[model samples]
Target: MAKSDSVTRSAVLHRDTRFVPKKAVGGKGSYIFLEDGTKFLDSTGGAAVSCLGHGHEEVSQAVINQINQISYCHTAFFGTEASEELARLLTESTGGKLSKLFVVSSGSEAVEAALKLARQYFLELPTPQPQRTRFIARKPSYHGVTLGALSVGGHMIRRQPFEPLLSSNTSHVSPCYPYRGKKAGESDADYVNRLAEELDGEFQRVGPDNVCAFIAEPVVGAALGAVAAVPGYFPAMKAICEKYGALFILDEVMSGMGRCGTLHVWEQEGIVPDLQTIGKGLGGGYAPVSGLLIGEKVVEVMDRGTGVFRHGQTYQGHPVACAAALAVQKIIQRDNLLENVRKMGAYLEERLRGCLGDHPNVGDIRGRGLFWGIEFVKDRESKEPFSPETGVAFQVQETGLDPSHGISLYASNGTVDCTKGDHVLLAPPYNVTKEEIDIIVDTAGRVIEAVFAKVNAA
Candidate 1:
């Protein structure tokens, strides 16, 4: 169906006001069809949410059946079976390490809940320390958009306008970014220890007794383009948090739920967070859902207290959302999709490197599992990023979206700071085929080449 000129003038507020985006009429498997009949291979899974892909029959049926049974039920009054089952599945997947779940409607909400829980956990202690109010987070990290989550998030561009409203209780340390943070002669061990020391110094500067938690993304997502830490990075950071009596919080909204081949990204890191937040692939884009996974320690504190979380949202545990997520998880287990993620993830890394490893402008290609990122620089040897005025990543994304290219990639900036770097992320569905992977890499190669060619011409 072709969209009329009138329809192009959408009533809904879009991300960009300068140009209206093409309307997507439908989607199936790994492709989204536009109103103009253009088909795009969804390489980034719409910001890595569509893990199971579009039009999954089982997930759709689960949502419909849930709506028919009971769509909405306030948690204050009662709990639904869908929420209970989903929570049980999630907790069991963690081997009871994260013993409880607080389902929410979005990743931001999950982060918000985790932050509140951290504060409340301290207050509930036998000798409550009201001074434990500060939070330490890493720079170039993204937690969420909600005020509290945004406060802890280190994305300066997103935080600048809202700085006045953000809490001053939060402080940021340098991220574990090897591409930029590591010195030329430094060993991985040395780099990790240096970062750990920085975090420890922040705790001291802020008065360790005044801090509640130290939060970070196990694998930095869009903000840093899937940058994972060095071998001992997480364990060292967790040790610092432990030393300071601060809870360790991991925001896996983009990296968890089998997106990185494991049920939880932290599983591969060898550390269990005191509070963990998961979203994106949880419902496989079938519904809006995210969750806060509470560890045994936090649960013990709550149990010893009033046994009630002070936060509540009307859709805190919507039946339809929980049902959709449960179905998505079940399919992942039944189909052994995580195994596919590992196999295909290795293939993707190999293909990306083989395709553009030596491109003069392609500075780095880093990722694990099915998630990957390609950073573009003006000079590869120096790792000098293209000027922000160039908008290299956004140009690549737009070029990929062109009907001729027919690909959709995720674009991000500020990998060097809050304003300097440009990178594109590719996160195809977990069940993507080898052939599709080939097409993704090939198309991405062409898109990047074409965009940079234009840049050179300009």
Candidate 2:
């Protein structure tokens, strides 16, 4: 709360209007300094956005350079080298598996644009698929908050308010959440087969060719709290999309850009999506940047037909944003941060398991690379999540915000279905040191223990 809780009548409406949050004056490396002179170690990097950490001189220089050269150029008029080079960097990173890039200012815009692009793609085909109007996504997933993205997103709490307004054409299936979704006797292979069959059934229910695309996150982010796909699950889903002639879309808005050890989470999953959305880490919080990576199939359609994508945004391909993202990507490559993510990700798992894995309330600890989550439960043996009224996850998160605990934790509720579960995410910067990992884990363990101690007493 710091000194902010005492204030009222803030002109700017915040996410939580009940209380004003502490004002963050500055940050560096893995820590943020508040106006109250408290220095909190940044563990989640503000929903896994600051992969390069806060206040990097190089990214600053890149943005400054681009501003000096030329800041904004509408894509409708002219193209800037900043956007062109950024696109080249993104596409080439895919090894030409994806051939085209469309940039935007945020993840929501990228997803909204991707949906429209998918629609346009079907329209421009050698044989147009005017009937391909629907989308299929997994439950407890989040793409973004924009109307179209909201329509595809399965986050119940987020979508509930706008349900009547959201597009009715989209539907949802079960995500590959092994901790809760798996049956008592189910093997990993059996669980995957079950999910695959479910997806295939949904495609059949909707009429195969009527679906424009099936979108999912490579690693489920805020909505499910860093839930990665089970082995063989993605390839199986892609096969269904292929059979239906529907595009496969991976929304890596929170998992890609080297957050999950590899440059792309699909690199580990062994299947390429027809469309991919990446952000959060793209500009490392230096500037607003998100993008759509288009596969060869759709690009071919656009190239042969209209030679244009039907979607456009005022801030698409923003020069300053592209420049910041370019520097962030280049720094990642030059510094060999992906290797650090792999090495540290393993150690992070080890540390978390050692410190908190056996906690009575800690039901599951899961994730890959630098992204991880800890799910809380009342009965560990039964995997029974605490009632949402308890606010177990956010209580632990709020405890950490105190200057005494001095660590940041990203909280998620409704993990079990949008109303019944709780978990917290820990996504540090790629270049985080082993020492920093020790501090983060140690502090987080203490914080979690402290909060749950109070819950038990109450």
The TM-score values for the models, in the order shown, are: 0.98, 0.98
Candidate 1 structure lDDT = 0.92
lDDT string, candidate 2, 147-172, tens digits? 99999999999999999999999999
TM-score of 1: 0.98
Question: What TM-score should be assigned to candidate 2?
Answer: 0.98
Candidate 2 residues lying further than 4 Å off, grouped into runs, are 1-3
Query: What is the per-residue lDDT of model 1 for residues 292-312, given as tens digits with 9 covering 90 to 100?
Result: 999999999989988989888
Q: What stretches of model 1 exceed 4 Å from their correct place?
A: 1-8
Candidate 1, residue 118: the lDDT equals 97
Q: How does residue 84 of candidate 2 score in lDDT?
A: 85
